[model samples]
Target: AQSVTQLDSHVSVSEGTPVLLRCNYSSSYSPSLFWYVQHPNKGLQLLLKYTSAATLVKGINGFEAEFKKSETSFHLTKPSAHMSDAAEYFCVVSRNTDKLIFGTGTRLQVFP
Candidate 1:
């Protein structure tokens, strides 16, 4: 069984500020976790991923996340927020069969 939970449905931040989004996951098999960002009406893009090989995963657009097995969490964080960063983010988990299950969604609001 593989499941992901995005703790917040929406997060608002000021432009040029830092951004943080929380995610927790549970997996019965060895887990492969990922964070994906999607602009409005756009396809999902890979932000970062954590395979068994790496715990700290760095992703595109200055975003990063750490996989914690004990806590069953993989939270995304960034030191700065660009106006372009305002979008929907999804936390995903891969089952052993190679299929991905996505979280509901997280809407990021950036105020100028």
Candidate 2:
């Protein structure tokens, strides 16, 4: 079984500042991790993914995450925040199957 936790339910950042969204996971086997974003009333879009290849993985929109096996963490980050970056982010995990375990979600708010 695989599960994920997003530490924060909401994250606020000023425009142009760095952004961070923390996530932790647990799986019986080595799992595939992913970060996804969803705008209001829109379908989810993949931000980045990790599949036991590289520890550091880059995603769209300047976002990246490092897969830490020992710590069981995969935190999402972006160099600079933009107003358009504000959205609901989800941390997902799965082992072999298409079914994904999704976190509650973290809502990012960007302020000028």
* Clash count for each candidate, listed in order shown: 0, 0
Q: Given candidate 1, what's the lDDT at residue 101?
A: 96
Worst 10 residues of 2 by lDDT: 93-102
**Candidate 2 lDDT over residue span 8-105, tens digit each:** 99999999999999999999889999999999999999999999998999999899999999999999999999999999999999876679889999
Off by over 4 Å in 1: none
lDDT against the true structure, per candidate, is 0.93, 0.96
Return the top candidate by lDDT: 2
lDDT of 1 by residue, 1-112 (tens): 7899999999999988889899999888778999999999999999998888778889999999998889999999999999999999999999556989999989999999
lDDT of 1: 0.93
